[model samples]
Target: MGSCASGTQVPKSTLRSGSRNPPFSTRPDLNLNTPWARSRSSWREEEPVTKPSRKLVGKCFCGAVRYEVADEFVYAANCHCSNCRRTTGSAFKPFAGIEREKFRLTTGDDRLLIFGEESGHDAHCGHCGSLLYSVVREGAYVHVAMGTLVDDPSIRPTAHIFVGSKAKWFTVTDDLPQYKGHVT
Candidate 1:
């Protein structure tokens, strides 16, 4: 036995028996007894859900190239080596290291530039000449240029590396750990 929204008596056969929704007031499918009708709230799934992207986006200075990388990183540093300084034209380079598999070029593959050999190389944006990342550790890892990031990352530079080769014109004022050579 069942009752309609207005308290009118209805035989169980006239209603969708075992339907979980209350006596219908305005729902179109409220009387149907399909799988989705068993749960009163299943109708909410009619629209798809969208989650915010967790990966970080990076791009070249002229926006001619772009990439996406997982927010997770194994290490981060302020690199003061002469090579890094010259490539970036700065006193130091802020970079985050992660497995090469996690770093992907999302756009402008034709304009992508590789500056070194296969085992180790610097990835740059050919159009804007932006230093994007470095493939190191025998090509298993990549050190991403923090300057090219368009999204806030989960990690930040924690130490200064290769300080021995640091330019005399610049002085590190932060209290981060300083490594005389390179990090292992």
Candidate 2:
């Protein structure tokens, strides 16, 4: 994680807000690692600028890293996988997938260092060591780290992945759905 003494603030209008919890699960899951079936170029060119369904704010531990999500998350998920737990040092990781173009770094880009793992990349503040967001794959979408955000993601875990390797201390109660390993 990166560290910094100061942070920047972005306007709130960039994101959307809603209280109703959105569904995070999908009936027919898609492979997360594979390229999005939709053409990237076409999506970028034609993607509508919809208002952010939820407002989410995040910063690094040292206040150096700051960011805002300006669009409603397409999906929010919880992972109990060993790698996620180990990397986050938490029982579970709550993440929201938003379009990469919608994510904005309000400040502290210099402090942001990306640690790429086999599963995903951890984006954090290099100065304060605050974990910001994880980019599962570059140029696709961002997995907003639920813990790092200042505002509630306002979404629920659609499914729990890697349940077979989940730690003993943690238990998922959402009941949305459970996958022993990768669902998509």
Candidate 3:
């Protein structure tokens, strides 16, 4: 008996008698069979999908130290610097950069040892003396030892850093970008 906002006269027959809810029209233009007409429960049943959380895990050689990173890496690089070579005992240190917040120590927090000053530190497992990661850029990034990773990050080293300090015995075979010093 009342008119809708569109100025169409809402016939009393359109509404169910004694019902407080709005009128349910039988108009063809309403298309009540469409997806928009389905109830919330019905809509969910039609499409059910869930995304799994992504986690990249790593551990020390002796498994004394374990850590995990969520989502994606910030960057990856093979550092040929003397410091990395000396610490890792390798020709080059393949490392991946991750945000500090996303990096978590799952265990062996007490057994973790830090070398160097607060400005820069190489974190390792005290028990097995396994180099885990280096806290660099004033603690803004964690340079994870790629060798320690148990899961693939799906990212490859973009460049070779500090090639000037690369060991003479080792030769870089890849065509990745090389930097004489650290990449800015």
Error of 2 at 144 (Å): 0.5
Cα shift from native, residue 148, model 2 (Å): 1.4
Range of the 10 consecutive residues with the lowest summed lDDT in candidate 1: 20-29
Candidate achieving higher lDDT, 1 or 2:
1
Best by lDDT: 1
Give the residue spans of candidate 3 off by over 4 A.
1-53
Residue-wise lDDT of candidate 3 within 78-152, one digit each (tens)? 999999998899999999998788899999989999998776899989998888999999888889999989998
Per-model RMSD to reference: 7.7, 22.2, 7.7
Worst 10 residues of 2 by lDDT: 19-28
Task: Tell me the TM-score of each prediction against the true structure.
Answer: 0.72, 0.64, 0.73
Per-residue lDDT for 1-184 in model 2, tens only?
2111222232334323452221222212334344664566567879898763565678766788889896478888778888788778888787888888788999988877788863567887888766678876645788888777887666766888888888997767665788898777
Q: Against the true structure, whose TM-score is highest?
A: 3
Give per-residue lDDT, candidate 2, residue 109.
88
Q: Total clashes, candidate 1?
A: 0
**Shift of residue 67 alpha carbon in model 3, Å:** 0.5
